[model samples]
Target: MHKPLLVPEFLDRARTHYGDSEAVIATTGERFTYDELGERADRFSAALQERGIEKGDRVAVLDPNTHYHLEAAYGIMQTGAIHTPLNYRLTPDDFAYILSDADVDAIYADYEYAENIEAVRDDVPTETFITNDVDAVEGEWESFDAVLEDAGTEYDRPEMDEDEIITINYTSGTTGDPKGVCRTHRGETIHAYLTVAHQEISDDDVYLWTLPMFHANGWGHIFAVTGIGATHVCTRGIDAAEIFETVREEHVSYMCGAPTVLNMLVDYYIEHEPETTGDAPVRLATAGSAPPEATIRTVEDEFGWYLKHVYGATETGPLITTSDAGRLFEADSDDRFRIKKRQGLAFLGTEIRVVDEDGNDIPRDDETLGEVVVRGNQIMEKYWGKPDATEEAFTDRIEGYYHTGDLATIDEHGMIAIQDRKKDIIISGGENISSIELEDTLFDHPEVSDVAVIPAPSEKWGETPKAFVVPTSGDPDEPGVSEEDLVAFTRDNLAGYKTVHRIEFVAELPTTATGKVQKYELREEEWEDEDQMVGQG
Candidate 1:
């Protein structure tokens, strides 16, 4: 009964119980059964060992959403090495910083991203470079396939302690330098169970790789799906047409993405109608930012898919809450749309509280804003090599809770609604304005495709909300909707104080890889000359 909780157990269970079942369909048209996939993972582990990689060594994976990434994950974990996944969207210099920070010893990179690693080859401490594409391999780099061909399938699983760090996921450095969050084998295992239990993944499920595997370990879906023996349908990148086609061809039952990806799919679906709607009902879990109610309605009504809005950060299991419409609201309730827009109840083993600055719980009135703090088994252990940052993150302010840094509110039904980021909240004339509220209202405008709201400098009121709009039609320089029209529209819908005072039409909003808007970037530009930010005043 004292078995150590390890990540490899998931793959071992799938290989033993579902040996002949199809486990993965790669973007390169490679198919593998559970047995074959397991063997490949073992071979990868053996190959790393042959290259002198040992337990506790850091192994970085730089690849897109492919079967090779999946293999690299399990392979690296099996060898007791810490797996560090790199975001392909990052620059070579960004990769260099992370590789050097994590003290990575070896890297398994996709050929498409090999150039990024090669660009920083001399800067990092990594000694071995393995490329999946053999032809792309040159000068001190090893071919992944060639190594697999020569390596044995019998790799000895390294003895691992459950509480030891298994992975280091770097945050998207939107505000500043990215911080590496260290996650242990125990934490990841607990997160996988929570994901499977809450999402209801099964062997009959076909999961499409819409979310990148680099993001919080694909939101821990990589372990959840594999644990249940589900089929993994890999895609190189997110393309609306390809996603729709794969859903029809593979009968994809479940997938996860940010609202931005859903918006792209909906846009494509409206323009070019696809004929084949699969036999099974499709389930999608979306996060990153609270989606507009219109987006949620479209996903449910037009696409006929079940939409679940999940919420969390890279440090908190990346899945601490979910808003399932059927469970949270009446089937025919008019307020269902509004309720579904909330971040919703905490996960099964998680606890969430919205508290005031004094560490007291805020009223469940859904109006008062407070910091949302969480305590759960799935929370990351610490920020790697940043003891000061880790201590500040888990300070006694909340007492045993991890500060989320998200300002939120709790409704009577106990659902949590994120108002805005603590730093992004606009304080104008002694009143707080939630930018998310204004952005949601603007999303209802037919001419507005995407929008970002930031606190712009205002000498009179300290700061005022500024709307950066991306139009749905016409040239970017001259949008269909004018500034006066948008200002009037918000005034009609929101309070006088919350109404956007300034409007600037732009081509598109800046977003992270996961599609969350980078409001801090806009804020920095607006407050560059100012000594302090809006809230500071």
Candidate 2:
């Protein structure tokens, strides 16, 4: 018997294997089972077909994490239409560019974002529009519910190959314009398998959707949860009280989030009473950053939650690696905390290597830094339209390997530690400095909530380290951290050059749509003028 690689097969297996299992529970308080979800997904497919949506048509969905959004993902896949999930926070102009770039034929948007869609309606190639909130619909958009109600249940799924496009994920381009990262059926299915294996999730686990759906298909949990028949609890926005309440009331067993979300939960647990049960403790998976050692300690000690750190980009299905295995440090709390800090080794069927510009493998000495490269089934096929961009990204330095553009060092145990972004490394006075190391140390301070390190001009040393910090409590204009005090604090922890020469407390640091700090923006502001550079040198 041949195996099916399509996404609908996964849904069919769930309905056949665990038909009555609870598939999803909406934040607005609606319960749905696997069988019900499958039926709804099929109904959505039929509705789209009735509107003349054929195979390979681009369909965009703009909404928060909800049951309808999940249904739309599967329904679009069932019809062989590419699912394009849009970030609701993006400006109308950004949305218009993506819509026109992808040549989307139809769009299903929430009531809150209908106006934005209408603003760029004439620019995009959209022929059909469906609004989720019927009462909130304006300017002649069709009702989503009415469309489904009018369409019959009979529908046929298009024949699709494993390499066919399933999703077009737009990555926030820091250097230039945003490009669409196209995901194929084979890539998505392989990544879901990798995630399930690395996370060790089972059918009994109750998954909480803390990460947004628009983010790499919730880091590909949308398929992993369905693959394992896990129950999903969807939350719109990150609210500490709401997250705590849902975890307690629903007894959530597994969830995923960025380090920012984990930091918030740690603060909540410290400030308020935490909910617990005699059953198993919740497992929290975090990525986007390595997470400060303090946040890792708090999650493990105070909340009694097992924290796993994963690392990946939108182009890699966002499930490249996870830190879960226990070493000798498993017995020692301090030692284990340090182990959790590493991005950890690769999952089964994935190979990771740190190589120099010459394409030679670097030693696992834990000190020599090199560009991290990978070869796996989880990597995306290519960027949607720009072939030159895809070629440049994939063929960066070493030949035939996907250059991650992340500088990393591998330890003796084969665990990878991210030094900094390839462009984030600061070269000051002929010495290569890791800004991430400085940022991690500053995060230890009690008053600091967020911190980013960038190079500042220096007359004597060529370039010096500057710290841009965000105070957790005080106003940025007058943060509690004085420049002198912070300098002294760093001098005690780090070396001479590593010590921060200047400090500025800002309201907040710039971040990408997926919550990664935009250090290049800070670099541009600091080194924007030619006269300033001449004077500093």
Best-matching candidate per TM-score: 1
The C-alpha local distance difference test score for the whole of candidate 1 amounts to 0.88
Which stretches of candidate 1 lie above 4 Å from their native place?
Answer: 137-139, 325-327
Q: 116, model 1: CA deviation in Å?
A: 1.5
lDDT at residue 179 of model 1 (Cα atoms) = 92
What TM-score fits each model?
A: 0.97, 0.95
1-537: candidate 1 lDDT, tens digit per residue: 788888888998999899999999999898999999999999999999988899999999988889999999999999999999988889998999999999999999998889888888999999989998857744567888888899988777778999999999999987667899999999999999999988888899999999989999999988999989999999988898988889888999999988778777876777787742476679999998888998888888888887888999999978999887476678766567788788999998899999998899999998998999999999999998999889888874677789989999999877899998888788999999998999999989987778889898899999999998888763578688789999999999999999999998987777777777777778888789999886752
Backbone collision tally, model 2: 0
* Candidate 2 lDDT, 330-423, residue by residue in tens: 6546878778888988877777889998878899999999988887888889999999988987888876667888989998878899988877
Candidate number achieving the greatest lDDT relative to the actual structure: 1
- When summed lDDT is taken over every stretch of 10 residues in candidate 1, the lowest stretch is 271-280
| C-alpha lDDT (0 to 100) for residue 68 of candidate 1 | 92
